[model samples]
Target: MSRVRHREAVFYDYFRQSTKIIVQAAELFDRIVGEWPSSKPLIPQMKELETRHDELTGSVIDELNRSFITPFDRGDIYSLISLLDGIVDGLEGVSARFDIYGVNEMVQSTRQMSGLILQCAHELDTLFEHFENFKRDGVVLEKVKRVSDLEDEGDLVYRRALGEVFSSSADPVHVLKWKSLLDKTEDALDNCKHVTNVVHSVVMKNA
Candidate 1:
């Protein structure tokens, strides 16, 4: 195939892999929140997601190294790949605490945060599909914004839940657990934002 053809193919694979990474991270976040049973089982789920991405990254970089041509700058490709990877890494770090810290059940706010997290993941999956036909598909950009809005909503729920937790919960240990969980939820939303930011930035540069 031609160099330009090879380049597009490489970028396409990179973008698809990155999208998969983001979606899996989001799924893990949702699983932690939505499937909470005070058992800390979701930690494994999150770890598995990270492992899948690790495998994807190895495959991508190996392909990149072998290719005679690429679609974008090698640095840009590397940076973009790492940026998406960081989101998953950061999310897993946050989740790891659940098992290490022994945080079992969480509050209503935590549930709200998880619900929003799941929404972001769904939206992102849609956004990536739209990214494929971005010019031919104006809906992708709109959906990215929708994910942003959900994250914002998540922020509000997080704050209010924390306030309630502080006011109603008396156990110091409980407070600590809820506070940490709240922070983790917020960080996950931030992760979603990072994905959106990267996608929008790429669109600006290319479009």
Candidate 2:
């Protein structure tokens, strides 16, 4: 095959691998939140996944630098990887806070957010599976909408979580700690949307 054809293949593989990394990180986030205190020991595992994602992102950047052509706009590829990386960072931040804040219990909102994050990740996985097909087919747009809808649900959970934090008479220090964790959870969810929006734009531009 020509070098041009090889470049296309390499680009596809890199994007797919990056998407897989995001999904794995999301699964780890779900497990960390689901198990909470018992899952404290898994923070290192989550950290490892974050590091792996960074490596994947770096690989994508290297590929972008060397390739004469890209599967998508180079800037879009960079932005998409950066936003997806942020999602993992957000997840790792939440896990780190559980230790830093000495949190012993998981709040209902945290669980809700965790579930939402997982759902968003799954939806993104679906979207990524169809990213290359978007120009020839329309089904990919539905996956984009699916992630966007999940983000809306996440926003509600985030607001309710914050409301509970401020309205309760919990210790001020406890309130601060919970607030930070909830914010991180919300940020992760939002990052999922940021990624989807970028995909949405790419699809529209190409479609």
Candidate 3:
């Protein structure tokens, strides 16, 4: 392969690695919420996932500077990487709260939001699958729309979950706890949609 093609391949692989990090973080967030064990192993799992994401982003930026021509715009690549990493930061922040805030008992509405986040995360797996193949098939745009739709659903669920959390609970402190958790969970979903937007932007510019 020519040097240019090889460099482009490296960039492609780096972007794919970053996308993997986004999906893994979202998935770990789901597991933490759904399978929140008393042992609290999920905390470390989430931290590790976010750490891997950080590593991938740093590598991408390093490669970006070393190469004169890139497959995609550096600005978009940086934005995409930052947004994907945002979910990890946000997810880990929420998961750590479980241990820090002494939340032993779980709330029903919070669990519901957790379940929704899992579903939303699962959708990301599929969306990124097509995205990883977009270079060959050009089908990621279609899947991005589907992911965006699920994120919209996530927003609706977030509102319902928050309403239940604030109105039904009597303890102000407990209300605050679940309220923050629910908001973070919803923010994770928003990050998923933002990932979709990044891909859509790439499609528009490249098409």
Candidate 4:
């Protein structure tokens, strides 16, 4: 491959690597929610993944600065990595909150939300896997739409979960804690959607 093509490939590689980490974090979060107090032991693992992802993010930006030619717009590349990093950051924050709030039992809605985030992360992984071919592969757009659909489903789940938190909990503290958790979880899903939006834009612009 020519030097420019090789540089493009590097950006795609960074994207794939970043998404892989996101999926790992999502799976870990799912397990943590599924196992609740027992899962407290896994929070550090999630934090480690977050730190790993941050390092990768810095590497991508460093690459972007060093190269003259890129796979796409510099701004889009930066936005994509920043948003990808946000997903993990949001997850790590939520995981840390479970410990900070001294949460004992798991909320059903929180678990459900975590499951949704995991599904979205998997879709994102698939999306990035196919992203390099966005110009020729129609599947790229389909993956973009899939992430958006999952985000829409997440919206419903978030609303219902928030309602449940408010209506069912007698203690205001419990409501506050779970509400914060749900908001962060939902934000993670939203970040996934934002990444797809960037992908979709890059595809359209290149077309």
Candidate 5:
């Protein structure tokens, strides 16, 4: 490949690698919520993924600064990587909260929300897989839409979860803890959709 093509490919490589970390983080979060205390051992693993994601984010920024040619708009590339990093950060934050807050049991809605997050993460992974072909392939748009749909599902689950937490819990502290956790979880899902939104814009601009 020519030098320009090779440089362009590097951005795509970063995107693919970033999405894989997001998926891994999401899966770990899902498992942690599903298994509760038994999954506490995996909390550290989520932090490791978050750290790896941070390093990947730094690598992308460094490459962007060093290279003259990029796969897409420089602003879009930066936004995409920043948003991807946010997803992992949000996951790590939520996972750490379980231990920090001394959460004894996992709620059903928490599990449900984590599952939705995992679904969104997988959808995002698939989206990036076809992103390099965004100009030629139609699947890119479809994947973007799928991520949006999952975000909407997450919103619904979050609302229901919040309502339950407020109504069912008598302790003010319990309600506050869950409310914070749900918000963070929802933010992760929103970040996934934000990445796709940026990708959609890049596709449209190129089209």
Candidate 6:
């Protein structure tokens, strides 16, 4: 292989690895939400994923510092990695809160949002693959739109969930705890959208 191809491969691999971590985090989130009310603490699993993501982020930054040419602009690469990491961080925060609040049962709204978050992440997995071909490929644009649509769905679910909590729950403390947890879940979904936007922005700038 030529030296130039090898260098470009490094950038591709870094983006792929970063997306894998985000996907893994999303899967873990689905698991935690599925096994909600379990006796075990799920925060540890999230913490592990978050730690791995941080290490990957650092490696990407190190590579960026060393490389003279990148597949995309240096700023865009950094922004994409950081935003992807933020998604994991946000997911980890929600898991930690679940443990801290001693949440024994998962509400339907939370469950619904979790599913949407997973779907959005899955769309991103496809979206990232087209990064190098962003200028001409229309499929990447479709994936971006799908992620954006899912984010809107997440927002709807979040609003309905909050309304349900307020109208039905008589305990103020319970309401407070669930509200905070739901808000964190929404935040994680927003992070996913942010990742999608970064991909879209890179395409637009280069198109």
Considering summed lDDT, which 10 consecutive residues are worst modelled in model 1? Answer: 33-42
The whole-model lDDT of each prediction reads: 0.73, 0.84, 0.73, 0.92, 0.91, 0.85
Each candidate: RMSD to true structure? 2.9, 1.4, 2.4, 0.9, 0.9, 1.6
Clashes of each: 0, 0, 0, 0, 0, 0
Candidate 6 lDDT over 106-183, as tens digits, reads 888988998998898888888878766778989889998998999999999999999999998899999999999999
Pairs clashing within candidate 2: none
Worst 10 residues of 4 by lDDT: 106-115
* Candidate 4 segments whose C-alpha is farther than 4 A from its true place: none
Q: State model 1's lDDT.
A: 0.73
Ranking by TM-score: 5, 4, 2, 6, 3, 1
* Tens digits of lDDT, candidate 3, 100-150: 888876665556656655665665556655564566655677667777887
Q: For candidate 5, lDDT tens digit of each residue in 151-192? A: 898899889989989999899999999899888889998998
Off by over 4 Å in 3: 37-39, 119-126, 129-138
- lDDT per residue for candidate 4 within 97-171, as digits (tens), equals 999999998878778888888998998898889888889988889988998998998899899988888999799
For candidate 2, write residues 104-182 as lDDT tens digits.
Answer: 8888889988998988888887777777677875667887788889999889988988899889846899888888889
Per-prediction TM-score: 0.80, 0.94, 0.86, 0.97, 0.98, 0.92
Model 3 weakest lDDT span, ten residues long: 124-133
Q: In model 1, which residue pairs have backbone atoms overlapping below 3 Å?
A: none
lDDT score, candidate 2, position 171 = 84
lDDT of 1 by residue, 86-188 (tens): 6677678767876677766667777777778777777876776666565557777787799789988987998899899899979998888878867866886
